[model samples]
Target chain A: MQLFFFKSINLSSMEVFFDENESYHIIKVMRKKKGDIIKATDGNGILLEIKITSIKSNKLIGLLLKKMNIKANKHSPDIGICIPKKTSRFEWFIEKATEIGIRNIYPIISHNTEKKKINYDRCKKIIKMAAKQSNNFYLPEIKNISIFKDFVVKKQKGFIANCSNIDSKKFNEIKLYNNPLFLVGPEGDFSDFEIEFAKKNGYVSINFGKQILRSETAAIYICSICNNANNFNL
Target chain B: MQLFFFKSINLSSMEVFFDENESYHIIKVMRKKKGDIIKATDGNGILLEIKITSIKSNKLIGLLLKKMNIKANKHSPDIGICIPKKTSRFEWFIEKATEIGIRNIYPIISHNTEKKKINYDRCKKIIKMAAKQSNNFYLPEIKNISIFKDFVVKKQKGFIANCSNIDSKKFNEIKLYNNPLFLVGPEGDFSDFEIEFAKKNGYVSINFGKQILRSETAAIYICSICNNANNFNL
Candidate 1:
């Protein structure tokens, strides 16, 4: 069953209205007619089973048959990482992270991989598709690009994954509290200054084992581990 | 230092030779002339630091300056997954799985995603590149695409990850004696027949969590968990 995205729906009224763009997709693209059954999520934990009731004035209207809330109360990982130079690599990271279930994703410009810009619309579309594909109702917020130094200072504390191999703690040994934010480094890894600064501020250094992984790979791996942790729920 | 691939090299000979294709890459593509140093691995366990001693007759020859073993002795998860329809998706799985460290990789043809033939050369290239990118010396062996029933009937047992919520064991709770093989399902998940057949043959059903993951994501997630396990090493 394909899951569609509904930005907003009136649950109490038991109605759903698709805008011009979505209407075109439903009517023209998908050829969904009146009485067609469809499932959609509002990205705010609400999943609605809707039956297309009317198509008028280039808009699609439906009556909500059922409503289900996907509990988003679970404290999952919110990732903060330096984006890779390859657009596909970074996009792949976003797709996998969304599928694996994350709360928020922050693209950090570090000393190594700095000043990389990500298209917000593209990221959002990818996230939406991944969520729909993976049956995840909670849409992770994509934050604007932030300087590494500024991000660390502002977030205060989290787990930073690096390749320094100095005083690094195994992932299993680390104490995961609520809403853990992972700070993964770029290609060459975080600079000495960046690591030291984060550590001083309370970001514990962690490694996903001994192998050296790509920036995007590291980010997704972090998500995988977080999703599988005992206390966590996706 | 760039990591190159050596299909076979003699340690006692204290010399390295690049074939015609590799010679073209070193001399033309990479623009590495005599006296230039390079690092390579035999994709078994040995990493070598070699210095270009001669470039003659379209062959690149070097003297081995250093030799180190990557220790392939540690047991790790060997993944057998039904190949995804997208070539890039399967390639991504191979790359991430290699980076995260796997003992062997099998692309299986199952009921749902049936008989998808993977390009062995392309997969091997990706695996080699991933191993080099991750600085992993133990290159994972990419096995031929095996029939699902034939595979289960032969292998006898492994952990099968599916969307089915039946009597699943948490990954941490699963006993990992050595070289645990992970069978991850395709997009729609394994056919009920496949799951039941495997179970009858001793396969334990497992789920990653609540979220449904892509076949590639599930394969990579299994690798991540295996790498972080206490007894495993990359």
Candidate 2:
């Protein structure tokens, strides 16, 4: 069944409206007609099976027939990556991260971060598309780009993955309550000063492994690890 | 110091020849002349510090001043991923996995795998480029694309990661003694029969995480998890 996006599913009337852009896609691009069955999610926790009742130029009305909530509440890594040199690459990170089930994504501007200016709106769109494509319930939370120092001050369980041989504590040993954040630097890696600052703030320096990985590769790796942490008997 | 790739680094004489390809990159592209110093790796386990001496159109020779084997020799994951829909995406997987220290990568043909043809030489080149870019010494071993059933029967500690919620053992919990292999299916995932066959052959059914990921994304995720199993403890 084709999937659609609905902000909230009303149980009483079983009616929902899609965004203007998405409505156009359904009526014009997809040629979806009335009584056609479709899948829709609120990008929160609601997944609904709906049938189109009416289609307009900028709005589509649907009757929700059945509803199911895909519970996405779980312990997954919140990987904060320093923006890359290209915005497209960074956008690619958003798509993959959403598919990988990242809980939260923070775009940080570190001393070595190559790309400073980030398009928050575009990044969010990529995240939504990936989420819908993968049939995910929750969308990854995107925070504004903060300076490395300010980000390091957070008291959350922290880890910094860099290119240095600074033997880091393994991910399993760390106590993961609910949300654990892993910090990935840019191509040049976090500066010596940034590492020391994180060290002082009690952010454990961790290596993703032996091989040196690209900035985006490191980010995806950390996210996968945190997501899979619960499976391992640590 | 900039890093360059040389075919071989002589230990006794501490001399090496930069291939015509690399020679052009250094002498013409980067505009570096004789007497300049740079770092070079043979993509095996050797790192060299050299000073430029003779430069020609066909060859560039450098005198090595110091030789050190700073290669990181951590455990590697022996996993194989099915060739994805887009050949370039599968090629990219080989590149990133090699950079992240994967031991063996095979292009398997499963029920849902799109691309059947395997270009052994082209895939090897991709791994080489990634190894050089990531500054890693070891090159991941690439195997010819094998049939799904044939490949599963030959390997042990094999895992099939799919989209289903079938209970699976976490990677870290599984004892990885010898080289282990995991078969990642394409975007469509493995057929029911394939999964049953793998299970009968002692292959464990696994899920990378709760979220649904793309084929290439799943390949990189599994590779990172298997390699960094020990990293979770910290």
Candidate 3:
């Protein structure tokens, strides 16, 4: 099954209008014809079954036949990661994280963070494409960039991944939290002071394995493991 | 401890020579002093504890203080994946698979295989770097590109991930194989004939999840899950 994403859906109108990108994709690219049925999500957990009513030059109008709210994945973890300097690496992380089912993404800044700017528009587009391809109804929110100092004050209860000497449990060994959040450090890793601060704010240190992982790779690992441990709880 | 990769190791000499890349990284980037102890892996399950003896412009010399054969991970899976056309995607797959502790990689070509060519040297370098970063002593073997016809004849017992209608179990639910081999298809996916042929050769169908994944993403997902399920068999 394929899924398309729309930014918004008006319940009162009972009609779906394809955006410019989706219109071109549905009409010219996919060659979807009028009266054809298709699935679409509003990226807010609403899945709509639409019957194409008209395929104009730049617009493909559809009548909503059915709509249902998708059940949110209870095990999806929120990932707080130091944004990498490389755009490709961050894009790859966004793609894989969406596929692996992430709840929220915190593009954070730590002591070692070199790149503080992100192309939010491009990132949202990538997220939308990934979510559509992955058939994920709920779009993961990309929280505004937060400095490690400010982030620790939130008192988020989850694991903090760092390549430092800290008494820790293996990622899979830790008891799953209700709303798990994983904070991954930058290439240089979280400084001793940052690690201690996070620890004081109720974040427990956890190790993915013996080897060191890149910031983005570590976040993906945490997401993958969280999905595995929670979705297939045996 | 950070791990470096060496192509080969000599037991008799009890001496180690760092190549230009390693020498530069050790001497320039990391700024190691004389008598500094560093770890090196030959990618053949051997680990060397080396002590810096001399440093030069393009050469770093070390004495092998100790060497030992590391135990191999018994549960590492062998992945047979159709090569993606994009260089970055293929490179990303190699890096992540090595980090996830894949035993071997077979770059295969199926009915829909588009790009048959691969830069073996570059891929090997990526594997080495990822293994070193992940502290993996054993390097994953990158087999020559095998056609699906020749690949199916091997009679490997493992799983094939496809979006076709096949009676399948969740990857975690399926009993783990001794040395798992996962065959993932290309963008167009394996043809119906190929899927049946693979089944005849003892490959079972397994689903990663409900969502569709890109070819490289699927391979990485399989590797990640295999590592998680095996390493944390609790």
Candidate 4:
């Protein structure tokens, strides 16, 4: 069944509607008409069984025939990373991370970041598509690109990765904590000054593994480690 | 320092030469001149320090000055997966696995797979570029596309993943023994007959995680788990 996204889909009510983009997809591209069964979510935990009520060109208003089971997001640690230089690479990370059950993805922009602007709308669409394809109910939180210093100082248990000679604890070696955040640097990586600033703050320095991974690669790897560690019983 | 790939490099005498591809990239793209220091690798274990000898339009030959280091590929468990439908998707999996230290990659062609032809040259080039870009000394062994049944039965330790009601063991739940082999299915996934056939031939059924991942996502996820488990005690 086709899945649609709506911000405030009230399952208690039998009526539902879609955003302009999603309505266009269903009405024009998918050619869905009245009485067509489909699925929808409110970007929260609510999953609804909706049937097309009417379509005015690209606008799709539907009837919520049944309320599907409310599903919770997976229990993996959240990973907030600095967006990479390439948009396709960043989108690739989002797709894979959604499939692998990453809770949150906050795209941070750093000083050495070559790619500054991000297409937030495009990224959100990719995440939604990936979530539906993977049969996952959770859509990871994709935040707007923030500055390095501001992101590092956020109120969350964070880890900063570096290539310096400073010894850092391995990811799996660390104790698992729920809703953890890993800040990945850009292609040139975080500058020394930025690392010092992060250190002066509460963020701890950590090594993902033995290999030197790319910015996007490190993001996915660290996300996987934290995710598995949470589910893994010692 | 810039890095270049020389397939015809002879590691025994520390002799490494650049062909048109490497030469053009170094001279025209990187704007490197004579006497410039750079690093070159054979996509094997050998790393060489080369000083530019002659800068020609067609070829920029370099003299091997010193042996920097011959770093061996990390001792991680081998993972062989079926070639996915999209060429770029398969290439993406190879890139991520190579960065995380996968020893071998066997691109199997399953019965239900939509893609039949494997672009070995293009895929290997991507792997080599990703390996060098990730500062990896060794490239994963890229095997030719083979039949799933033939490859699994012949391998020592084989596993197949499928969407069944059976609750298979999670990847990290397993103990490490020999290098592991995981057969990831295509878009439609492995057929029921294929699953039963693999099971009869001594292949164990295992799940990557709770979420349903795509073929490429599953391949990279499983490789990370196997490598992490193999190096757990170290």
Candidate 5:
């Protein structure tokens, strides 16, 4: 089934309206018309089975036949990673994380982080596109840029991926009881002081493997492991 | 230490010459002078430490100081995956697989595969760049496109990743003795006939997780798992 995404619409109501852009996609591109049924999502865990009712000048009106609210995946990770200096790499990370079922993403500005600014809207668009492509009902929330120290103090039981040779446990070795958050450093990795501070704040240091992975690779590897571990029941 | 990649260079000899492009990069972009030391790789498990002797119009002469030969990672996976229709995605897969320590890559032309012809030279360049960036000594050999049935008959103990509802083991559940190969399908997945034929020829079916993953994502997941499992010594 082909899926479409919508934003800021009330999914609870029986009637839904598609604005100009979506209308163009539905009527002009997809050639969908009245009485045609299509699958649509609002990026809020709601999947709608909608039937087109009418087409106004440049708008689309659809009646909802069914609304399915998908429950959040309990095993998704809340990933806090230092934004890379390269924009494309960071955007690629967002796309993959969304497909792998991440719960939330926090772009942390650590001591070694070179990129501080992020295009939030563009990131959100990428996330939405990935979710629709992968059939994910819920969109992972992209948080604001966060300071390393302030973000590290958050009360969450998680592990920080670092390369500091501190005899840290392998990611799979730890027992996960909740949706754990993982912190991945930037290209140069976290400074020694940042590692010490994170350790002092109850963040357990963890290593992926022998090969030194790039920042985006580390984030995806962590998310993949978490997703695999969580899907044992399925 | 910064690493540079050079092709067709003799590592055992005392003198090494850089061609026009490399000389331009070293002289203009990086601004290295004579007597400066640099690390270079031959993309065949050889790392060379050389000191610049002289600079000509568009060439660089260097004297070899030390030579280091890196052994191939015994745990690297020998992966056979269908080439995705999108060139960028296929290129991205090659880059990630090289970083994750894949020994060989076979582009299989399965029934559902869309792209048949690949730019072998471009693919090789991408692999070399990734190996240099990740500090990998050995470069993965990219094989030519092979037909599905002909490729399936080759005697190899491996698993095939598919979305079929048949009973399949998780990637980590199986024990890997030698460097095992993994077959990933295209966007449409393998045809039922292809899967049956592969199973008849000794390929076991394996699943990544509950979610539907893209072709490249599945490949990376499989490689990451194999890397982690084989790195028990580390």
Candidate 6:
């Protein structure tokens, strides 16, 4: 089933209207006509089974047959990863992280981080697309870039992923808490000073074994592990 | 330290030679000169630290200063994922699986699989690139595509990832054996017949929680879990 995302819309009513772009997509792109059933989401944990009632010149109206509210996953961890210098890599991280059920993503800037500027709007679009594609109604919150020091200080408990020789704890051994955050460094890795600062502020050093994964790969791997550990309650 | 991949080389002696492409990269691209130290791998669990001795017109000669053998990760899982119709997604899976450590990859063809043809040579190149980039000397063995039924009979253990409502076991609860192979379906997913056959033939159905993930993301997620679970011996 294909899902389309609509933002800033009240879906509580029985009938709803789609904007110009979504209307064109439904009528022309998808070749959907009257009485066609479609799955749509409001990017806020709501899934609607809609029936096309009418198609106008610039708008399309649909009647909601059923609504399913997916409860937000409280166990999903918060991921604070340094944005890589390459835009595509960071975008790929965002897409995979959204698909893997991350609660929040904080793009941090460290001393060794090469990329400083980020296109926040483009990242939001990627996250929205991935969320819709993955059948996730709740979009992962994307926070503004923060300094490494400032972000570490705010976190009460979590692990900082780094490959330095600091006798870092293995990820599986750590006990996860609700809304726990994991911090991943840039390609060059966090500077020694940054790691020390994080360690002093109650952040445990965690290593992903012997493999030297890229910054984006590390973030996605950690997010996947956290998702599995928390959602394994089933 | 950056590691470069050199195929089919002898590291027993104190001196070694680089092929034309590697020579050009070292001498022209990297602007490396004599006495420069570099790290290189043979893609077969051998890491060599060498110092450049001379730069010939077509080749570069280097004297080995140190040699280290990275033991193969016996815990990495064997991934049997269907080759997705989109080449990029399948290629992305190959690259990430290599970085996260997979002993072997079997590209299977099922009833619902859209794409049938696969370029084995191209996939090998991708695995090599990813292995070298991640500092993994043991390159994953990429097998040719096989029929779905034929592939399922050979594996007695391991789990098949699917979303059907059949009380699939959670990944964390399963006891992972050595070199376990995980079967991930294509975009349309394995047909009902395929799923039933797999279940009847001793393959446990496993679910990665409620979120619907893409085929590639699911493969990487499973690989990450297996890597963490098996390598946590520390």
Listed per model, the TM-scores of chain A against the true chain A are 0.92, 0.89, 0.93, 0.82, 0.92, 0.91
Each candidate structure's TM-score, on Cα atoms with residue i matched to residue i, is 0.90, 0.84, 0.93, 0.85, 0.84, 0.89
After the best TM-score superposition of candidate 1, give how far the Cα of residue A172 lies from its true spot, in angstroms: 2.7
List DockQ, one per candidate, in order. 0.56, 0.48, 0.52, 0.48, 0.42, 0.68
**Candidate whose DockQ is highest:** 6
Docking class of 2: acceptable
Give the distance in Å from residue A121's predicted Cα in candidate 4 to where it truly belongs.
1.5
- Pairs in clash, predicted candidate 1: none
- Supply candidate 1's per-residue lDDT for B18: 75
Clash count (model 1, backbone only): 0
Query: Candidate 2's error at A104, in angstroms?
Result: 2.8
Q: What is the per-residue lDDT of model 6 for residues A1-234, given as tens digits with 9 covering 90 to 100?
A: 778764334457678667787788778988999999998887788888888888879578888888888777766888889889999889989999999888889999999888888898999989988987787878899998899988888875778999885768877778887778899989888888888899899999988777888888998898898888777654
For each of the candidates, the C-alpha root-mean-square deviation to the true structure, in angstroms, is 2.8, 3.8, 2.4, 3.7, 3.8, 2.9
lDDT of 4: 0.74
Pairs with backbone N, CA or C atoms under 3 Å apart (clashes), candidate 4: none
User: Interface RMSD (C-alpha) of each candidate?
Assistant: 2.8, 4.0, 2.8, 2.7, 2.1, 1.5
Q: Write the per-residue lDDT of candidate 3 for residues B5-116, one digit (tens) a residue.
A: 6545556877788788988888888888899999998788889999988887768888998889887766788889998989788999999988877899999999998999
lDDT of 3 at B54: 81
Q: State the displacement of the C-alpha of residue A186, model 1, in Å, after optimal TM-score superposition.
A: 1.7
What does candidate 2's lDDT look like per residue over A1-234, in tens digits? Answer: 455677555567878888887888778878889999888887787788888998866689899788887766466678889999987668777888887778888889999886788888888889888987777778888988888888888643588888776656554456665767789989888998888789889788866544667888888777676667655533
**Model 6: per-residue Cα lDDT over B1-234, one tens digit each:** 767755444457667777787788778978889999998887778888888888879588888888898777666888888889899888888999999889989998988888998888889888977887787878899987899999998775668898775767877778888788789988877888888889888988887777778889999998898889866763
The sequence of per-residue lDDT tens digits that candidate 1 reaches over residues B26-64 is 788789989999988878888888998889877888899
Candidate 6 residue pairs in backbone clash: none
- Model 5 interface RMSD over true interface Cα atoms: 2.1
Residue-level lDDT of model 2, residues B1-234, one tens digit each, is 456788776667767888888888889888898999888887666788889998877588999888887644444667778788887677767877886667778778888887889788888778877887776766678877789888888885577877766666555466654345777878788988888889999888877544567778877877776667534321
Give model 4's TM-score versus the native structure.
0.85
Docking class of 4: acceptable
